[model samples]
Target chain A: MASGEAILAHGSAAKRPGSPWLSGFVAATISEIKSLYREPAALAFTLGQPIVLLVILVAFDFHTTLPNGKVVPYLDVLVPGLIAFIGMTVGLNGVLFPLSRYKERGILRRVAATPMPTGSFVVAMIVSRLLIALAVTLITWIFGVYVFGADLTGSAVLLIAFATIGSLAFIALGILMVAFARSEDDVAPLMMLVLIPSILFSGAADRQPRPRPHRPRHRYPRPRHLVRRRDHPGRLALQDGVARYE
Target chain B: MATIPAPTRESASHTAQPPALRVANLVKHYKKFEAVRGISFDVQPGEIFGLLGPNGAGKTSTLEIVTGLRDATSGSVEIFGIDIAHHRAEARALLGVQLQESDFFDHLTLKEQLEFLGACYGVKPDTEALLGYVDLADRPNWRLKQLSGGQQQRFALAAALVNDPPLVLLDEPSTGLDPTARRQLWSLIRRLQAGGRTIVLSTHYMEEAEELCDRVAVMDRGVIAGIDTPLALIQQLIDTGFKREVVVRDATLEDVFLHLTGNTLDGVSLDDARKED
Candidate 1:
């Protein structure tokens, strides 16, 4: 084949609006998923760790007394918090470790040398990590409901919305961490520095769980429910803007 | 004949149709170090261009700029008439890069790896043909790490051709290979040039530069020291009263070694699978 013809055959495909980028995203996501499956360790870390934590929380018969004098199961609160934690772990390791590895081992350099846009590659990464985070969220939610008998008292959509937003926020933070770090080794401490605090403050596994009592005056901070409460206004405003634009 | 056009002025457009690759006054400056200082050259279509330099001589930096991996501090690179600095994606469409390090997802088989890369370019690779060309047809299901150094380099070469790019950039394609492996890679590169692709390779091996490159650019300290065909460069030196202290022998030690030991690429380690070629 003529050289120009060869280039033209592939070049035209890349010219399509969003298709090239979307293909890049899809390729990256598929490759990531495939690689994750191949790595039992990575799979255990991303999927199994959260499940193991849930199992521990359930196996221990953990219960916390709420301020409303009702005893809420630990699974009920920890599951949601774990959703954010899932976001943290998946987002952090997903983007940061892989990105650093790619940069170090020349994977990023190899791909960057191609015609593929850097923006698309990054977006693909975020999308792929978000996907893993979403999978974690789904598995945990299912585990919470059936396995542990945790009630889905709130709207499922709202849970997903909060989880999605939390995951995105963590993913963004992971990118920031990557920017600050020089190598893959440097990311560990940096990740822990940010990761531990976010998980603790977000109430995924806080030290304190409010005890039950007939005290109407006291408002105890619920960690798991905090995601919905804190993010509900932002979600509402987003919906409002979308409605206004529509 | 592909003449070495005098280094043109920065930012000036060529009167003729643009070459396959043109790098003019390219410079790359890190915080305190200048990686590439104002280097300029053009690659004619269908020629095997070589950049000969030591480590940290800015050859890779220059190629990276043309490939759009790193940004140039000042100046421009055009690939097939499209300015890479401005029209990167378009320019990138015409280029393929095989880096020194073989960077493949370890878990992925060769076919899957090529499929992923092809998807990145929004094209479906003819995987069978690519594998066949790289002489890895029998080992399509092999993971990257399972392959030997030579096999990995071959796989990388296959990956570079997934898009059938007209301009292929190979950065030290045979860096860590044994002599046989290096020769196999050189033959593969020659086949690429035979297939009408313009290849720009970077290497420190004098033999590799002399044997494969149509023209060689000798770089030092981020600058182009000289640019010419290997024959012309040698001829110029000979005309300037330069003489070799030692007599050149027709049968060298490398040739004797290859003759005593069969020149066949050792593919036995890859699951007892021998290459078809």
Candidate 2:
């Protein structure tokens, strides 16, 4: 057939890197994270974006009153921003961000040269992103819980899962972005101009009127067992002037 | 087109040595177009071996296969009595390859890069010694983007040696360097060889191959046309009674440029490039 097809056919037998044993996998995972931290520009842009937004949203007062005549609380507004931030961080870090550098400078080819097992590179990349994304999510939650008093009524695990799946969705998008990106210069504009807008429209920013899967709850769905700590957002509202002061 | 030198058994004797690296009947193809058609040769240990060929002659393809970058269609790469097909890691551990290209984290220091690559080979080396070898000890803290292209190659070479591997691959190491920088790199390669490292390098420079390589493999269209010492290959073209063409050509324009501009890659441009204060 064609040359591309021939290359693909050969790629079907693409040799793998190293065995993914428990210890080896973990080592590869750490190496991947180290690689990410090594990149100053990428880490700064990826991690700093959300933090900057978080500070801006919390520190600045928004005077928008809700439909119920209750003020639209900063925490309520900040919740969607945090979710969007987490999703973007995970998806964009290695996905489309380094594709150009990898292609232009032969980083991917060099990495492929190492004997670190077949999928180790990708796995390491994803795992590192997941860890960093988790850190960002936790940081956002802490800021919400202490600084803004977010009303998280659902299961903590479910929230984490939702955020993770959200991250994965964007990460896939990021890979697709990389695939489309031809040169190193194409990456920055692609992310800023294309990826960000799509994510914002995906209902991550408002908890806005979007269709979500309504899972039928078992009548006695032990929602109390989810978090036992003192995290009553509504109660906090009552004690703290009901989002009127801060 | 260079003539294929057919030598009698006696002439082959003067060139033959124990093989540091050996390949037998190696073949790799994209589909119908064979990238490395059948090629074979032996590289002696501690000698700088050069694989010279024009672009698309399978120079890179062969290097990739030998260094565990790309696997062959069907062939064998043996290094120091270890076969690549079976004991890949063991064979690879014995060899350090300076890939034709690589990526480094922009945030990491030269020292940190060395450590990461050393760890890749499970090597615990004196990163200091490695840096000193490449003349980059002073700028260890600088990130990759801060360094010039030539310095980056130096750091890459140091990383390749972190394991103190017996066999090293240098692919087009001198390709982008200026004349003075190229001379500096040649000296460094000589030093590494002095330390008893077997180096296999690929390049298009006929002069460089004649100067640095003890044994040479000339390739065309993914196949080996000739494998011998540079002297013998040149001698093959001249029938008999060969007078050595050993006249030193006057120092060329690069030398003139070096005389006019000096050695170091000016400090003023670096100040402008350093974005981090």
Q: Please write out the lDDT profile of model 2 over residues B94-201, one tens digit for every residue.
A: 777788867676645777766655555554456666776666767778888887777778777777776667778889888888765666666667666665677899
Report the C-alpha displacement of residue B274, candidate 1, in angstroms.
18
Q: Predict model 2's lDDT versus the native.
A: 0.65
Question: Candidate 1: which stretches are off by over 4 Å?
Answer: A1-19, A203-246, B1-17, B247-253, B266-277
Assess the local accuracy of residue B100 in candidate 2 as a C-alpha lDDT between 0 and 100. Answer: 82
Candidate 2 per-residue lDDT over residues A1-246, each given as its tens digit:
011121111011122243323333455567667766766876686567665665554443332333454444445556655765677756775667665666677766655554445365566666777777776787777666655555555677877888888777767677677777888788888888756687678654554321111222223312221321433222212223344222
Q: List iRMS (one decimal) for every candidate.
A: 5.3, 15.9
Candidate 1: deviation at residue B115, Å? 1.4
Error at B10, model 1, angstroms = 29
Pick out the ten consecutive residues of candidate 1 chain B with the lowest summed lDDT. B268-277
The pairs that clash in candidate 1 are none
